[model samples]
Target chain A: MDLVLLLQRIFDALFNSAIYSSLALALVIIFRSTGLLNFAQGEMATFTAYIAFVLLAGPQPRLTGGGLAGLIPGVPFSIPLAIFGAVLCGMAAGAMTERALIRPLGGASDVALVNITIGLLLATNSLMAQWWGTGPRFFPAIFPTGAGQHFTILGARLRYSTVGVWVILLSALILLVLLLRHTKTGLAFRAVSISPSNAELVGVRVGPTLMYGWAMASGFGALAACLSANSVLLEPNMMLRVLVYAFAAATLGGLDSPKGALLGGLIIGLSQTLIPAYVPFIGFELSVLPALVAMVVILLIRPAGLFGTQRIERI
Target chain B: MSAQAPRRFTPVSVAGLIVLAGLLVAIPFLTTTTSLRQATQIVVSVLAVLGVNIATGYGGMISLGHGVFVGVGAFATGYYVGDLQLPWLLAIALGAITAGLAGALVGVPALRIRGIHLALVTLGLAIVFRPLSKRFPSITGGVSGRSIDARFDAPGWWPSDGRMASSVYRYVFCVLIVVLVLWATWNLVNSRFGRSMRALRDNHMAAAIYGIDLVAARVTTFAISAGIAGLCGALQVLLVPFVSQDKYPAQESLVIYASAVIGGLGTIWGSVLGVLARTVLGKAGSALAGYDGLGPLGEFFDLLDESAFVFGVGLIILTFLFPRGLAGLGRKNQVPK
Candidate 1:
């Protein structure tokens, strides 16, 4: 491959990985602590992005007064504020879902719990369609837009959005790492994940910690949604295919490890971008196949994933 | 007293069975052609649900890609009978066998990953099925899909003619196949292998320690279920006379799972009940959506147009209310709950 083409693919992969890692990280948070894969993670993220859109949407330059858009009066819809609000809203939604639905079904079998999440997925996606109608809506760009917003690196020009995505992803990672490692709540979360009964015995307040874990994970999911909406616009079904990719990434990384999620997401993102660019037969139409097939192959060889601890099955 | 007790059948139960059989046979005469076709579709759904029951309910393997098996079966039949001009009967059997082989391929991963993980793997299979179907233009007819001109017409002895004849022909075959499969499933569940399969589902480690070959049983169960699902697909194309990529989206897989769960997971009768409930409720939901009498309530009812909402709520409510599913309603010894 030419160096320019190779460099462009690398940059594209990095940009894509930023979004995938955010989602995979979110999935890992829930799986590590709750022992259940949040199948609705992507839908939850998209729902939060809709909240972001509602907040960011304002009267056009030609229009004067606003009704729902001017809820704060004279603020004229701030993108940063909307992003912040969406993240908080996502956290609240995640916490509410955990407390209201998942917690109540704690006694149900794993299969039942999984099915409930699937139900949640279907309900949430359709709710979006019913509420907003089933069409792609204009989502405002959070990054700067200009013709001169490109920099040549290794003979390939990178857009400002690419850099912006990386910045957001890195900040989210740092914030999560610091929170999990330093905070008392984080300690309690770790304690509960290791052993809920033991953590409860130690007065760690297991339920709240789990709720916190979900909240944090969902906040990351909202961020991922914002990053994704930057390119794809907003639609109810936008995240469905992305969710499959995230699942593949999570499986490849190790469902129980945050770092693994990040690394796995990068690997998957790179392969998905590069394979379609290079391979003659499989084009963009079958782009999703390689990553998923790779994940399955990895799983068959090492079921626990690259960085996950092997589960010891007791007799 | 010296001889063994004679086989006993209560008069009421015997009467109930006769009435049920009468109703089953009378469906074609009683309902319109469209309704008869819908009934055939429901039977096809029941067959698919039964496939789910064998693997998930009986074998303890959670599959989210049962629809893919059905799609494969449909595509197989479409290619064999439509393209190759093979006999429809032979095409259906081959389609089912092809689907069974695909199921076994999917089951190979189950040997490594299971539970929700297995579910995720199956779900990936479902997601991949759409694009994969598009890739093979010759077999699946690419994005446009393929259509069959050969109609399933009633035999010479039947009374109906024209479209009704085809409807009656397909309906008769569906009923026969449903009954045959149901009986075979009943026997399977009562047999030694059935007991072993149930044991494996309940506790795989214990079953394995008890001398059961876990891999063989699990893979075989998946194969059988896939075969049944494939048959449903073949019957569906036979009834509808067309097969397209749009016909079997990934979402349909979830709907199939919902049907199996709604029907009562492991029980054969539950599979039938679940399909019946889904078809009836689905039609009722659409009817409720079109009902325009209640002013603002009409708008509220219109949301029922999104069947996912109804089925999602149904799945949750049923999981909570009747863990054993709707068919478990009258049984005093319902398991799980």
Candidate 2:
């Protein structure tokens, strides 16, 4: 019943809401185009975060060991530049993954597609562990997070980092909206999402359009990872739990709806923070349980989700 | 019932069985008691993979959380044997039944959820299992897992009373149970119910039209599959005498599912082949990891030490090359879709 405390929790929850939204958006993009869930999305994003770490730290052999540090230039880059570079790498990797691993399947069974994505998840996860040790590393914050870096709103401290992340997310979203609404490639992507065969019939190049979608999705994932790395710490398994929340968000939003992803993320994020604060049994570590239960309930009762199109099955 | 053509065994398969039998017998003698126990554990893992095989392959429902059932079996068996002072065999049976009941509970939700959605739910279960198990300290041993006071040792009438004798006894017991389960599963898959299970998998609506009870078949398939995995977990406790939540990670479930896919899903032999492949790949990877002198490639070689890495790469390569899996290689028109 404490209004200020509740406001504080809600403000704190907004940071995670943005993160889940971006990751869920990434998932929605792929599902819309390819009708496949990228189980490896979290790991792929974490890998980019590591890349950004390497770029910022240069060739610190003690930190990176004999891993990927040797491959990069021996000069420490600025944080924004490093993140930008990592996002580009992430985009490239996403495009390549679709072309190499997914394209060859040519619409295989659900089992086969699941196998590929799960395979990628396992491989990338262990590869990261092998390269960088399993121990968590300290990642520098993008925004200034000093003791007095928060604004006082109704006696609650709203951190500057949270506001900064939201600004970046809104800008990126606006850019995405502009690109989708006023570009040839965006039209092709929309057409392909509606119907791949129809888009191909009109010569929109379905494969390349899907590839772009994957790239964009991966880019969003990279941004989420880099921004949140400082809070969560850098580790190989850092994103595993986050992936569950993101998946829940996507499912709640409607798997193939972009706006649903954003809304779902907001709801999931608020509940994730608020539920644990109120309920003693569902502690911090167990907050994911509610998201999962919500996902199951939604899937059972409303498969289409809030913003998604209902799927009609043919006998 | 209609008469069907008798099954034929290929010369290659006959030779394979003979070699496998020889290896199983020779394993205890050739290795130390420690390695012998490890070998027995590997053999026991086949049941878990087979569990995934039944649900994903024959039953046409993908279960990425079989490891949770295995954990349930181990934890339940430990509680029964240690706390209730039940006989080991009865405890093991009860443990499997408990896991089967749990599987049935999960299968109720699975009645409406299908394909990828079911996969998502199961994966969520896999991730949640560790934290959930940690909540029950008395049964699951909480954060650090508790050890069972009772040890599964050899009987007095066995020729020798040394540690090696007990190790050998456990090995033989595990191998016998694994074979018995395999034999039982082979028969189960060939029964009238098995045919209906397959029919439902291929097309549920058509199968339902043909008088197949969709709900009963799916739930039973999951229960039986989970029971098999539970048996594997019971044996794990019998071998190690310890149960921990750490043993059943989300990745472990994925690896188990990967093994089922890589080995060939539909065939029972595929489960064994998948486990064998995992063991061989793991041994080879560790051996290669021990070697030095590879300048730049040593880092890549280091990654080989992790079985998850090996299995991941193997899963992808196998998916590309042999979609039907290793059991499907060089054989045609045998495995049902």
Candidate 3:
């Protein structure tokens, strides 16, 4: 009701969207490489987030008020180091999934792979719930002690969590774009995307290249998971909307286009934030409405996705 | 119809099915209460799995939203029986019919599109459908859910002997519903309509080119699948006297797909067998994890996680190793793919 408070909430929403966009980018990366929808994508992110949670719970070095060690005296390792562990965990899970689960089912139908991923999702979720007991674990935020916490810009209070999310997302996006554009691995990845058989014939290690693609996607997914985990309580259901929103974003942007995921994510995040705020009929209950509407619109107008090449199936 | 041609009425298959029906009829007399309880669980699981079989197995359509159909059926049964005060049998029929019609409607967009797009839509359906069910508390019974007790009564010929009589009637109802489904599905698969359904699955383009009528065939199949799923929901409500949306979540659709795969797609017996395996494995895992008998064996075990992890790993392995499922595996051993 208060204009200042409302703007602050909107700012917070935008800040949090960076994580969703980043995850959307990860999904886009995998789709670009393998053309698989990767149903287990969000769950894979959850696995890593849980890893980060466990790592965060480790013993911490003693610190004075100004000392770096003062934050949550339990975690033995540096926050960055724990993040590294989580990233590795995410990448490894992604690789194992690609090599063990996906590769073996090669030449099978698309539905089979999707179904397998769906199964993977349930399996992973159950395993985690059994281990973690379905309770939310406190995740340590990476922002500086007083960073982005209740800073008023244009009379709106903004949290450092929001700002940190945006910064990480932008940095990751830039890194990803650069990697895809100029790097040798990126070139090979793009080649695989365009034509896997042709790329393999042209001396690209197509299999490993695809695996790397999954690793990269999952790695970014982990970052998104960690960032979002800071803001929201990380539960088994934490990543539920990640996949849906990401899929919609990726689809709207162009299923196979990384840039599309970013645009799609931002657009979705903004709409999701803005719609419920401004629109009268669509209340909080319809949280998923914006993403769903955007998706239907994109699919109807551009079935191949916003930025995807038109697919033509001939007899 | 002569014995020499396809039209021949040998009734071998039908005769075998009837005998199986008779065996199912005898199940209440043979099994313990514990076993009957387990069997009841299997029946419920199979109801949802039947929808998955219809949507995923036979149709070559992987729907992660069949849970919604089950939920819809359950809620409808709850409303019909719990509120409208309808007969048990009519409630079940109506519930299934309602879900079937809903499934047909959901299939409209899918009738035009193909692949991942269709899947995303269905996934969205599963996600949204749950909330929608929750919102309509008056019909759905909301969070608390509604209990259903009106089952086929004890026959006039048999005297009510307390616990034994009650359990027997419930078991009979469960078995009767299952056998009826199997028999109906058998006739469905062998019928021209069934063949067309298979054809549509086998080669959608070829079938369409040959005049299979894409809209009618696909939509009808989707409806039938949803209807079967609804029938399962109603049966479960009848058996357990409980119907809740939480019982059928978006994830349940995934579980059903896994069941369909393990059971083998495109076969009636496979669907039944798949449901049995799923129920047994899932139940055994949950039950035996804390079992005292496994004191010595317990050191080597954790059974519950097996279902959770194994479901996904199993699907991945089966798709790789035996794409045709258990039925296909059986057939392969008998002859060859």
Candidate 4:
């Protein structure tokens, strides 16, 4: 392949990595805080994206141009306000799910917990299908999506939208770092994740911290969903495939490590892009194969993952 | 007067059994061939659900990739019959064995991983099955998949048209196989081996301390479970007599697990109930969607077209209300909690 083409592929991979990392971070946080593998994370985010879409642009635009918009006639349509509202809703949904589903079934076996999440997955996806209609809806872009919105960088054309995605992700990461390291609530959340019993004895509110973890994870998921919907149009089953990719990324990076999730996402994304280009045998249809293969191999070699702390079992 | 006799069957029970037998016999004649096809699907699902019950319900292993085994069985049948021009029965056997062997391969890893990790590994297999099948075009017939030309028509003794005869023959064939398999499974579950398997599921360290070979029990359970799934796949192709990559997807595994749970896991009769519940619920969804009587709520009714919503609600309610499942209802000495 030509140098320009390769560089462009690298750029595309970076954009994909940003989105995948966002989803992977969401998965990692939940696993770390709750000790539960939430299978519904992606679907919940997809539901949130649909909510944002409906707020900003829908057949029946309740906030923008019709329904509720008439009640407040002075304010103009704002995508930013729509996204903010959607994220807040996402946080509430996360808190509600933790309270309603997880709390009620407390002390249940792992199988039961997993099944409940699976149930949530099915419920969320199908509910979205019913409300949004299964057909792909045109989600208005938050960044410029036109072909003209690009510039040559070292003989390689780079889309401004891709740059926008990176900027959003980078900002989210910085904010997360600040929140977890410098804030009192973030310390409580971290303490709970490390040792819930200790945190509780130390006067940290364990239940609310866990809920905040879910809320933060879901908020990131909603942002990732909006990024993806901008590129791939809105559909109910869109997250199904993406969820698998995120799983591979999270597992590859180590389930409990945030930095590892980002690294794993980038590695998987780049390999997915580069493999079909270089290797003629594995075609585009099997683009996901490399990431999965990488995951399995990494897991077999080191079950704790590349950056994950080794879980020392004591008999 | 002091000697008590064993009550073999209550009159109501005997009468119910007779009624059930009569209905089974009359179904092929009374219902249209389309309905027979539905019955065939139910039997196949029962087999798959039973497979899941053996591993997850009886053996305490979580797998979300059983669909791959079924897919393998279907593809194997398609390859043998379509590509090799083999007999239908042999093809089915080969197909089932292929799935069983694949199951054993997966079981090797199950030895190390437990709980969520095992679930992840199995799910990975399901995700990989599709692309792998697509990659091997000569074996799997690529994206479009393979179709079988071998037909098992009715014998000369049966007096019926070709279509009806074929449907009845398929139904009878499925029923016979299901009965035999059910009997075998019942025996397996009740035997001394079944006790060891149950011990293993209930407690690993305790089972190991009691002279149970952990590896042997786990492998055997997986093989048997996978073999049953394979059989279901083979039977499935014979019903429609077509196999494709699209026939079995990863999400189908979730439905199979749900069916096993909904049927009341580990119980023999629950498998049938689970399939019946699934088929009945599906038909109800379509019916509910078709109804146009509700004025403003008609829009609400239209949402029933989304089968996953109904299934999700049903699963959550069933899990909360009766963790043991529909089969746990109205049994002697039954204790749910």
- Output the number of the lDDT-best candidate: 2
Residue pairs with backbone atoms closer than 3 Å in model 2 (clashes): none
- Model 3 segments more than 4 A misplaced: A1-9, A59-75, A144-148, A278-282, B1-26, B30-38, B148-160, B291-300, B303-306, B333-337
Clashes (candidate 3): 10
Write one digit per residue (lDDT tens) for candidate 1, span A138-205: 88778875777777897787878889988988898898878879999988998998888999998998
Number of the top DockQ candidate = 2
What tens digits encode model 1's per-residue C-alpha lDDT throughout B1-337? 0111113544644674587588788998888889999878877778888898888888888888899999999999888888888888998999999999999988787887778888887877887788878988888778898777677777798877876787888898988988899889888877889888888888788889999998998888899999999999999888987888777776788878887888778776677777777777778888999998878788777767777777777888887777777756655555562
**For candidate 3, lDDT tens digit of each residue in A129-179?**
765657887777787526545677889877766776777777867876798
Best by TM-score: 2
lDDT of 3 by residue, B258-330 (tens): 7877777766666776776776677777677767686667733463645756577677677667776765663
Model 4 lDDT tens row, B1-337 = 0101113555654675587567668888887889898877776778888888888877788877888889888888877877789888898889889889989887877777777877766766776678878998877768887667777667788777676888898888888888789879878877878778788877778989999999999998898899889989988888887778876666677777777778777677667778778877878887888888878787676767766676677777777767777766644444332
lDDT of 2 by residue, A1-315 (tens): 999999999999999999999999999999999999898999999999999998888867676533465576655778998899899999999999999999988888788888998999999999999888899989999899999999999999999999999999889899888988899999999999999999999999888888999999999999999999999999998888888899999999999999999999999999999999999998887898999899888888988889899989887
Error of 4 at A220 (Å): 1.4
lDDT for each residue of candidate 4 in A186-272, tens digit (9 for 90 to 100): 999999999989999999988888888989998888888878887778898777666767778888889898988888788877887
Record all residue pairs in model 4 with backbone atoms less than 3 Å apart, i.e. clashing: none
Return the DockQ of model 1: 0.59
lDDT at B234 for candidate 3? 76
How much of the real interface does each model capture, measured as fnat? 0.54, 0.61, 0.48, 0.42
Q: iRMS of every model, one decimal?
A: 1.6, 1.0, 2.6, 2.3
Model 4, runs deviating above 4 Å: A1-4, A58-80, A151-153, B1-23, B137-141, B144-146, B159-163, B330-337
State each candidate's clash count: 1, 0, 10, 0
- Model 1 misplacement above 4 A: A58-76, A145-148, B1-23, B332-337
TM-score per prediction, in order, is 0.93, 0.97, 0.88, 0.91
**Winner of 1 and 2 under TM-score:** 2
